[model samples]
Target: MSLENTRHPAGPGLDELVPSRYALRVGDIDVLVVSDGILSLPTKMLAHDADPAVRAAWLKDMFLPPEMVDWALNVVVVRSGDRTILVDAGWGADPNLPRAGRLAQRLEAAGIDLGSVTDVVLTHMHMDHIGGLLVDGIKDRLRPDLRIHVAAAEVEFWASPDFSRTSMPPGFPDALRTAAKRFLNEYRSQLRLFEEKCEVAPGVVATRTGGHTPGHSVVRLASGGDRLTFAGDAVFTVGFEHPDWHNGFEHFPEESARVRVRLLRELAETGELLVATHMPFPSVGHVAVAGDVFRWIPAIWDY
Candidate 1:
């Protein structure tokens, strides 16, 4: 596979509508990369406290604006045999994040019915990752067949009494805790929690790689001889080049950096396809050791 250096246009006021879906066949399993839309985060909000000059240089090299970073909200959908699994729910019609909440639309474009999703494997309880699980404040439990899988430690951490006291911007932690509780209560019967590593589906396994959040995880899918890892925010493109540059949203920045480096090295050596949730639209790629750090070579459009 040849690497293509395709630079996506970036700036304010640009039309946000781009191809929001991509398809790949991993042996017998079908995988789809769906977009919820783009999120415009101030460059400073990410990799916070890093030297401004260093951050600006990296942005310049990547052709991104130094003031703001536009990140694609990529969600993974997996269909293995009889199961239709969604990796992470997108922002889902959230009023605060007007640009996002388009996952339902993109799923329809990909010919996936919302009712057909058998399982939702969440990497963590971040709003963007779990917001789409509900529609109009209602969990789609009428189907009775839909199940939600998350890490046990994640649920414990968020549900703990002290979770709301975490050092976060004013009401953010409280809001997060509320959202998590709502999701858990709404899907209580359908909720399943795993620890360390365990199979979530026939060809899918969830491995705990906490750092970004207390119980953040990455899901691996294998069928026949092909493998793919849904690396849910383990790092972004910039993180590959500088694993030490921590995201401001990380619960444990130091541990997040350590996990990022370890995972990147392992992914590079194994040569498995990695799908990052916040890289670029269709954030599927391969990792490679580049000098002292790592590099991301995006997978060619497999459509």
Candidate 2:
């Protein structure tokens, strides 16, 4: 059948009118799961080397649409002691994604004043992760005392000449490079780079987990013996079932898979709260070992 003549089933229509905020207390800290919006990509964009039939069957078995993959754009806000820290800014104001760019609004809904954010911790420099730092290329200087913390390796990778000339899919490298440059230039004065396992806040530390990018890191929040790991993009919901599957957006698929598997195992073993950036809205969960693989056990909803 001709591609145009083929009739593929459709999934549910996009829902953008739902509440995008959730909150929970960890010991003395208040962690808020703030939603920026949803991101939709074609399923073919994942597991590129896997057989198409197998991929379709996997999605079908999961009762998900075989054609598209939907991920939430969730960021975390931690109120520890007298400090308010934001983990990864969402896409600020992108005309292309109307549903997104709601971080500012959601923050307000959660009773958080943008001006009160004292620290911003970045898991990586991926556009979605850092785009919300600026709206229309203008840094949100609402917090005059704002300090932006990022992985030193991440900064170095994006700033390297090699990264600039690296070949990428059409219409990708240019935009990514441009944003990287803009982010660095705008936040130069406030940017604080750190090595592996450096604390970005009182109880928050950046753990080196590069692979998605040259310097992707995961932020861990520990308080009163309770722990939560904000696994930037180390693994998505689907990735729990297939830890070896590599997403197309990863810089180094092999390394990304390796890091993902290791992290999943550790999280599962410890039963720590796992907050994924691309899981369902308010993406807070725990990893459990299911046979030889890992499973995502969503956190109990308090509301």
Candidate 3:
């Protein structure tokens, strides 16, 4: 169904319209999951080198379609005391790609004003993640005042002209260049580039977990004893079931796998809330360690 066709009333199975957003409070810090809608990609995008049987088994286990991979666009909203921070913007409208551009309404539904967003913590520079940074309804320029935070390496990789000429896949160089220029022109002052670890705010800190992108990072939110990791796209679909399986969308698959393994293991051991961008709806859960493998247990809310 198209973004406009599906209507998800408060119910189960995550109906198409207005997918669920969940929130949890920890010592005055509110972590909210804002739905940006979902999109489908070719199944091969999940694993480039896996055996067909292995891929088939993964599809069967997840009850996903064998031909298409469904991906959810989830943007995290963190309300820490006085700051209303948005981590990783969602998908803007694209004629070629259908099921996107639903974030603005969802943010409204969550009672979050775009103008009120003080900071944007990016995990990477992928289009699906950063496309929403640009103003949609308006014709020109992105939000000028919003502090858009990203890793230095990520900004360098995506913004570099050499990257567009040397690294971008065939037929994508022009598009990449356009995007790079747009980011540079529209969000220059708002862009706060950081290296390694940097404290974004009082409750959130950028953790170095590069691989998905050159300088991809995850945001860690902690208050009192409760903590949560906004794991952007470190691991996409079936992240726990196959943390070793490198995502095809990642810039460096090998490095991404290493980072995934380390991050998953740590989250499993520490028992922190894992908020992933692409999981099931309201992608809030905990990773359980079983022997050397990890298991994803979805949140069982009282609502």
Q: What pairs collide in candidate 3?
A: 6-17, 7-17, 8-17
- Clash counts for all predictions: 0, 0, 3
The Cα error of candidate 3 at residue 193, in Å, is 1.2
Each prediction's Cα lDDT score?
0.79, 0.78, 0.73
Stretches of candidate 1 exceeding 4 Å from the true structure: 1-17, 161-171
Error of 2 at 80 (Å): 0.7
Instruction: Give one digit per residue, the lDDT tens place, for model 2 in 1-303.
Output: 111111221223322347677777776777888789987777866676567898888889878798777768999988887788899998778787787878876665555667888899889987888888768633554676688888888999887524331234466667777778988998888888888877766788888898888779998888888889999989886688787776767878888889999998999888889887888887888988877688888888885
Clash count, candidate 2: 0
Tens-digit lDDT track of model 3 for 1-303: 112222233234334444456667655577777777787776766776678789988898879889887788888888776677888877777776667756766666555567777778888777667777655553233345667788888878775534311233355547646766776677777788888987878878887688787888999998998889989888665657777675666767778888988898898888988888887668788888776677887778634
Residue 223 shift from truth in candidate 1, angstroms = 1.5
The TM-score, computed over Cα atoms with residue i paired to residue i, of candidate 3 is 0.87
- Which 10-residue window in model 2 sums to the lowest lDDT? 1-10
Task: Tell me the tens digit of each residue's lDDT in model 1 across 38-107.
Answer: 8777786567767999888888988989887787898988888778888999877767778888887666
Off by over 4 Å in 3: 1-18, 137-144, 161-177
Against the correct fold, how does model 2 do in TM-score?
0.89
After TM-score superposition, the amount by which residue 207's alpha carbon in candidate 1 deviates from its true location, in angstroms, is: 0.9
